[model samples]
Target: MTQEEEKKKQRTRNLVVGGILFALVILFYLITVVKMTGTGA
Candidate 1:
């Protein structure tokens, strides 16, 4: 593929990975908050 196409693909991959990482972080934070609250949220 061309250099520009390769860069675009890399950017897309990075965005997807970043999104998943953010989601995991949010899930972890929520789990911790629920545990602290003791409501089993």
Candidate 2:
């Protein structure tokens, strides 16, 4: 593949992985916050 094609593929993969990681990080933060608060939310 050409450089452009390779870059496009890498960009797509980065977006997908980044989205998953963002979601997991949000979930982790929320869980920790709830645990610390003991709000049982």
Candidate 3:
């Protein structure tokens, strides 16, 4: 493959990994909030 194509592929992979990480963080945050409120109430 060409250098430009490799760079593009790397960028796309980075974006996908970043999105998955972001979603996981948000999921964990929501779960924690629910657990906290559930026990507090």
Candidate 4:
């Protein structure tokens, strides 16, 4: 593949990975909040 095409592919892959990581972080944060607050002490 051409250099420009290769770079575009790499950028797209990076964005996908970053988005997945961001979603996981948000999911974990929400889970932690629920675990802490859902049940009263």
Q: What's the TM-score of every candidate structure?
A: 0.89, 0.67, 0.88, 0.89
Q: What C-alpha lDDT does candidate 1 achieve relative to the native structure?
A: 0.97
Evaluate all candidate structures by whole-model CA lDDT and list the values in order: 0.97, 0.97, 0.95, 0.93
- The digit string of per-residue lDDT tens for model 3 on 1-41 reads 99999999999999999999999999999889989889735
Candidate 3 segments whose C-alpha is farther than 4 A from its true place: 39-41
Candidate 1 vs candidate 4: the lDDT winner is 1
Which tens-of-lDDT digit does each residue in 1-41 have in candidate 4? 99999999999999999999999999999888988897634
Residue-wise lDDT of candidate 1 within 1-41, one digit each (tens)? 99999999999999999999999999999999999999994
Worst 10 residues of 3 by lDDT: 32-41
TM-score ranking of the models: 1, 4, 3, 2
Give lDDT: candidate 4, residue 40. 32
> Where is model 4 poorest over a 10-residue stretch in terms of lDDT?
32-41
